[model samples]
Target: MVTYFEATLAQLSVHRVGNKGLNEFYSLSDNTLRIEDETLRRLLMQYFLSPFEKAYEVFRFTHSSDDLNLNELFHFSSMIFDDQSAFHNLSGQITKHLFNISNHPKIKSGELYIATFRDIQLEGELVDAIGIFKSETKESYLKVNPEEGGFALSYEEDAINITKLDKGCLIFNSEKEEGYKVIVIDQTNRTDAAYWKDEFLQLKIRNDSFNKTNITLGVCKDFITNKIDEDFEISKADKIDLLNKSMKYFKEKGSFNLDEFSEEVIGNPKAIESFKNFSREYNEEFDAGLDQPFDISGAAVKKQAKVFKSILKLDKNFHIYIHGNKDLIEKGFDEDKSMNFYKVYFKEEQ
Candidate 1:
């Protein structure tokens, strides 16, 4: 009765590489993943289609401050929660936000938000937590912050609170003069995180401002000022050749692990072959569209990668056992209606 996330987490262990560390396991929760014996940290980056430009940035998010890589953080927190390690705490505030998201109808692929609930207190007496979330289609319902902290809401009067998390992000809580300070995050561009405002609409950060203009030529501009800059880069012919050559690292050293990591992640060798074949074919097509020595990946490439991620499976024989074999389901499986259990047929020995 192990959930995919639980099973996947059990397989992953924190493996460090000098300064940064990569998650050496499959993240069945968000997406499929694999890492074993090879320079696994590097292998996953390519396998997951984590772009080279954002590589270091994403890498840092895993092992930024100290030795506790992302996996270690999960391993540590999982122990605290009776072995239910579902989320990594972004901060006290971010953790609360994640809690709210643990239950949802549909959080669109690109859709993300941060919200707050002011003057909300839980004395353990209330049947439900304070705060209301009203989606346009459905009536508003009372909810609680998953973790703790952040401005999730602006009551007619006090407190700001945020709930729900999409990725690894920090929620800020600054102190004000009178009682408390203001709470807001700029997410106009993709680099910035998004937050829900009174359940109305979230703001988007403008790419123009975050990108082109800000460069860390002299000093580091952080992710905000350099958002656009991070998204694009200009490379000469030699570097392009190096990248194409470097990619072999994933495919080459990746082979020793072929029998294990890649095999498990892809499930069937045929599927793995298909993925590799397509990667090469599409890589050529993608490169064909680029200009001169400089090149960038278009949305098309990332889209295909997502498609591959979904269909890729680690267990060929894996089955989703609902009420398995409890009853004989006639003509089998339909998600809409629940019928009966399934039965397996076998041949008698002659």
Candidate 2:
């Protein structure tokens, strides 16, 4: 549970943007370029406040001389600026645009805060990180008067509401096998989730075994819902029971054997064959494979659980849990012809 500070950006100072650099002071030249491009500005806002969100794990920054990633980043920024040398380049680029934001009609004032972590514990590992956040706040005042004609407006600083996180970015110093991982958040209009994820952070979307398993499970659910199971002449409960068995199989076994799973869960020869064909079609359609051993991800299983429902909701009265013993259940209409009923037979009431 890390806490953050919020204060008015009264002035732009070099001290706020780290001390070691050729450029140390905020000057008129810094105001030469404004953040006019909507896409770039939106990304900046997103990157600035991303670390504060709970979904992401934070880390501490390990900045010093001869940091390669930092150097590469500086080079990247310099290329963007088309400059040979950029002292205090990252902050300069960010702050100048921030200064120009005051001129925009929609944005009047903003809050800029710097975040430095001593160390961050993430997934049982501690790492260094740095973050910056810019939030747009709506400021107002309350008028109070003790005497007549002596009313004074008190600036409601405490009530200042954060309308949105205009821009933010957080950088971690921990070295991954490929590169440093970063998080960026944007609330602006022009860009989407992919723009920040792909273009700015250069993050590779996870398409691993866990993701593939989720997709395959989702395909099975689709097959059941779309009446592809009708060819097996199985009842609705039977269809759900088969799906539940499939889930249980994945949970219990390390590697999924397609033939074995089809035999055990689906049972019927026609249904098993249909399931195999469906699995093949799913693999080919989504660029995934199901033949190999893929360790199931607990997270993926939990996420897909809601989608793989095994309950039959009958009107508003009964929720039939149809995960087992489909043969004991019978579905038909009553003699009145206005009511549908499912007669369930159980050995004992547990």
Candidate 3:
């Protein structure tokens, strides 16, 4: 199974500082920027134009500007298009994916559990830096922040921020041999406790005992697709996007199936129609061995009456080829529920 396609490149981003003599560049709270090492902004700029970059820059500073939240940022960017879906379900392909930022935790119902260093005590040489946040809400998240001078991160008011809390903080320094301080009486559950245990383990695995970059953050995705439910996972893997296109040729001289030719993926409806009709007429005139145009009366005429023109569905990822031309996209499809043949029919201004 194919996985995620993440291309990480390290390049300098242009962040400005006032000419007052010292650097006064942007910050995430100021729009989530830094005076130096703003790699994410640079990457976004390369794909997007200057106006977009500036907008994002402004947004980062405003905090209210980002389109997606941290969990959403981590989720949508991680998946890609798949192949099996096209050959199988053949409809409603993931034309595109988007990331939406939100204030609430993406995992439905997990609040960040907060405890001050005073709340928890430390003793022996434990590995992961553990902070015991004692909040009424038993939710928690472990975020890695490099801009924080150290890898310490502190969440204030549900927003991610850099922290000065360090070894002095038990969460950042897992030197305690004893179990974590008991859960608050009001906040108690085996499931919640289990979640904390896993969080601590993942943290310890990441920063303390061993160094593993890939850590699991509890998340849930509402998988939306036109394909079968079983194939949802497969269609999201990173793979070569197979653009499918089919052309049927009909010539006058001989019934030509166009087995000798190939259709280019060039996006032009007229060019597409010209090819399909020319092939169809040519085949009718020649390949069918029809020496003359005659009236329809027999089984051949009845069969020919049902003959439908080819269809074309143009999209960002791949084109779809159904045997019959999509009169539906132009007519506006409000068809029955179970009907799954989805493709926008090219609408020409009549």
**Which candidate has the top score in lDDT?**
2
| Runs off by more than 4 Å, candidate 1 | 1-165, 168-191, 194-236, 254-350
Better of 1 and 3 by lDDT: 1
Q: Give lDDT tens digits, candidate 3, residues 1-350.
A: 00112222211112111111122222111121132545744443232222111110000000122322222211111121123222111110100111011111221222122111111112222222112221223224566678756676765355322121111112222212222212112124445343222222212121210011000000001111121133323221110011112212211212212222223321244434443454456446433322222222222222222322232433455554443333333322446753334445455855
TM-score of 3: 0.14
How far is 84's C-alpha from truth in model 1 (Å)? 9.5
Cα lDDT tens digits for candidate 2, 175-224: 54234545555556443333223333344323455566677678778777
CA lDDT of each prediction against the hidden true structure: 0.25, 0.53, 0.23
Ranking by lDDT: 2, 1, 3
The sequence of per-residue lDDT tens digits that candidate 1 reaches over residues 1-350 is 00111111112222111101121211113321234555754332222121112211101112233332233322233233333232222122233333343322232222122122122211111111111121111123444444465435422322121232123221112111111111122223232223233111221111121111111110111211232133334222222222222222223331223234335433445544544444345336533211111211232223222322112111465353222221222224557775433343435644
Model 2 deviation from the true structure expressed as Cα RMSD, one decimal place: 10.9
Segments in model 2 whose C-alpha atoms lie over 4 Å from true places: 1-88, 91-118, 129-203, 207-213, 227-235, 281-290, 348-350
Best by TM-score: 2
**TM-score of every model versus the real structure:** 0.18, 0.53, 0.14
